[model samples]
Target: MLAKLILRNLLHHWGSTLLSMILLSTGVGIISLLLAVNKQVEDKFNRDLKNIDLVVGAKGSPLQLVLSAVYHLDAPTGNISKEEAEKLLTNPMIEQVTPLAYGDNYDGFRIVGTDSTYLLKYNSSFSRGSMFSNPMEVVAGSNVAKKKELKIGSSFTGTHGLSKDSDDDHEHFKYVVKGILNPTGSVLDNLILTPVESVERVHSERHEHAEHEQHEEGHDEDKTTGKQITALLLTFRSPQAMFSLPRFINESTNMQSASPTLEINRLLGLLGIGMDSVKAVAATLLLVAGLSIFIALYSRLSEKKYELALIRSLGCSRMKLFTLVVSEAILLCLAGFAGGMLLGITGMYWLNEKAADEYSFTLITNNLWNKDQFLLLTGTILIGITAALIPSVKAYRLNISKTLANA
Candidate 1:
């Protein structure tokens, strides 16, 4: 009976109730969306950064080097000579050096040329077939296999560049899907991995073919540079190497080394500023919603005093009148909370689709409710109760005879 009365009262003042609900939902939705995106992005970054201490690549922005070499989110600065990178393997402080060569793509998925160490580092295992052991043999990531419908022994020629739109297909050499990897929820999930020699072989042949064509035209130009890999993922034996190695490589060698941890932290710090601003806006909206609820209830209490008094005369307790007033506010906030959750979930779904399409990345959406969202629910309920308190008190203390005579 109390709930029905609260519902009817809210329906009678539908315009103001809707306005408050919209404000609350918008605020909650924005905060919830940020929480989901931030958590997933940070988790993905930290997951991929595991086992990788340093990234040695061509001289450029350290952050870009990390983004490109470690995360495969951006174009590599440039290629570093394989011979030059191999020199780091001799260092006593270095534990593992995984060479990465990026030059081609299949259906928008990057083809990374690295040895089995790359898979081992991510603890990846075959979903179906065996790992690639020979040149031109490739292992497809789970997403690549599913999206492109690549089966074991399937053959596809890569486009000459990183993008699927590149028309320069390497028709001379084709890659066979030797294996498909189980999803590791890391950067490897979208990559096509092959032996480093395969990438070197393809580009080497392309360079040779171009040179031969030029030679035939009698315009001989030396365009050949020795084998180059895009970057090297380095793991150090000791923490001391972190201080000296990146500086040595940046200062002494043509290549630049970047620490994934440092770069990612810096990136998060920059992102935090934008997130904080949005949080402030959401907070402001919530405050406005609370104020709106307060004003609406306070004004409505004045109009409903006679009705409240008549109910009191009919033996309704003072506490029940107070409960009735507060219940209305709680009902509106509950509706707003439900709408907000739906809005946030829809926003996250859209964001995941956009991220996957644009960056070949997707945010984790499995757990929609977390501690922060629970706190949001608690805070919302508190706001409802607080906003209706004064109005409820007025209802509780109403003079039935005086209100009835005034009416």
Candidate 2:
């Protein structure tokens, strides 16, 4: 009977009920989106950082080098000689070396010139065809293939520079898609891989007007194109090298240096500030939703004073009367919470699709519920109960004679 009464009352105030539902759902949806993105980005980061012990790159801010080389974002920190990367491979503590060369793009995706070792480190394999075998042959990431609609034999020209609006298009050389990697959901998802020599060949052909010109500053073992690498990925021979090697690479040479684990953690801490603000705002909205429930219930009690008096005059205890009114409070909270979670999940994907339409990049949407989400729901529900307390007390203190006389 109480539930029926509550439903009927809500039906009568359809405008307020609908507004409350929208507000609650919007609050939860925002929090859900935040949680999904934070988890995914962090997961990709830790997975990529696992293999690389020290990153050696050109002389600039070590953080810049890491951002360009490791994360594959932004421009390179200037180029390190292919010779410099080779020397590190000879280190007694070094296990493997993967040199990365930059400065080119096919469409909006970054074209990274790297060797077989880079793919091998991630345990990545082509679902179709094989890795790049020669200069100008390229391997497309899963996202790259889908975005560019590229096939194994498809061809495209790379731009000379990194800018989204570069005029110097490298139409001279054709990059042939040789392979498409299985999706790994890391930085690899949106990249193209090729031989480090390709970076030189394309640019060298462009600047071939300059001739080899006594390449004095940076080259190694007959690097005919005189190309410099953007960075080197070092897998040290043992755990001890994790500490000793990065320092040696930093101090002993002119190159910038980084430990991926430490740097990424710092980056995450910085990102957490933005997430904390979102969570705080979600919490504040939940409080407002609870207050809405309280106000709506309290006003109903005011208009229904004769009804409360009739029930009280029939010998209903103050405690029972209080509980009867508070049940509506519980129903409001639950209805809002369910509506909120439902909108959060569906709306997040819809928003992601909308964002993908604007920016060329697509946000990944395969997220699942976790502890944090449950805790958030619990916290919001607790706030709802706390908000209902004052209205519930007012319901308990009803005087039958006074309320009925006024009615």
Candidate 3:
């Protein structure tokens, strides 16, 4: 009987009740979306940082080196000599080395000149065709192939630089699509992989052509120097190397060494500040929603005083009247939370699709029953209970004689 009365009363004031629900749901949805997106990005970054201990690049900010070499999200600082980078392999503490040669792009996707070891590092394998076997042959990531409509035997010229707007098109040297890589959910999914030799050869040929033109025009022929690589990703053979290697490279050599773990933590720390501010705003919205609930219930209490008194006169106890009001508030809270969660999931799916299409990046969406989400729901429900307390107390203390006479 109490439940039926609570339901009917809520239905009677559906306008204000719905407004309160929408406000509460909007607050819940914003916070939930933030948690989901932040966790997904953090997880993806950690997963992609596997097996690589340090990144060695030309002298510059260590953070920039890591962002460019490991994450492939920033521009390279500069280039170091290939010979200079190979000397690190001579260190007994070093177990593996993968040199990266960057400088060109095909439709906003970086053309990464690396060896088969690069693919092995990410645990990537071909999906359709085989890996690039010779110069002027390249393999595309699954997303690249699908979105760009590229296939085996298709050919395209690369731009001189990483940006898609670069007009210095290397039309003289075209790359044939030799293979497609299965999605690894890593930086590799956004890259065009080829042999380091191919990158060197293309630049070498371009330099030679310029020199030939200079010689024909009665100018001095400019001689090109030794080859350079953008950076080197290395793994340590011993735990001791983790402590000693970065210090040695930073202090002794022209190149700078960056620890992936440290740099990533720093990146996340900076990212957290912005997220925290947004979370604070979401929290404030929740408080406002709670206030709205308080106002709505309090405003309706006067109008319902006579009905509450009649119920008390008939049979309902003061405790039952209190429960009736509290239950209504809780029901609204639950409905709002369910609607908010649905909105959050839908927003995340849309974001995931957009990211996959534009950046070839994947966001983690499989883990929805996370503790943070449950905690938010629990907290929102608690807010509803708290908001209903004063109104419920008023309902319990209603004077049947005075209310009935006034009515």
**Per-model C-alpha RMSD:** 1.8, 4.5, 2.7
lDDT for residue 200 in candidate 3, whole number 0-100:
90
At residue 80, candidate 1 shows an lDDT of 91
| Residue-level error in angstroms, candidate 2, position 26 | 3.4
Task: Compute the lDDT for candidate 1.
Answer: 0.91
User: What C-alpha lDDT, on a 0 to 100 scale, does residue 231 get in candidate 3?
Assistant: 97
- Enumerate residue pairs that collide in model 2: none
lDDT of 3 by residue, 80-101 (tens): 9898888898999998899999
**Could you tell me which 10 consecutive residues in candidate 3 have the lowest summed lDDT?**
355-364
Clashing pairs in 3: none
User: How many Å off is the CA of 9 in candidate 2?
Assistant: 1.8
Candidate numbers sorted by TM-score from highest down: 1, 3, 2
Among the numbered candidates, top TM-score falls to 1
lDDT of 2: 0.77
How does candidate 3 fare on TM-score?
0.91
Error of 2 at 55 (Å): 1.2
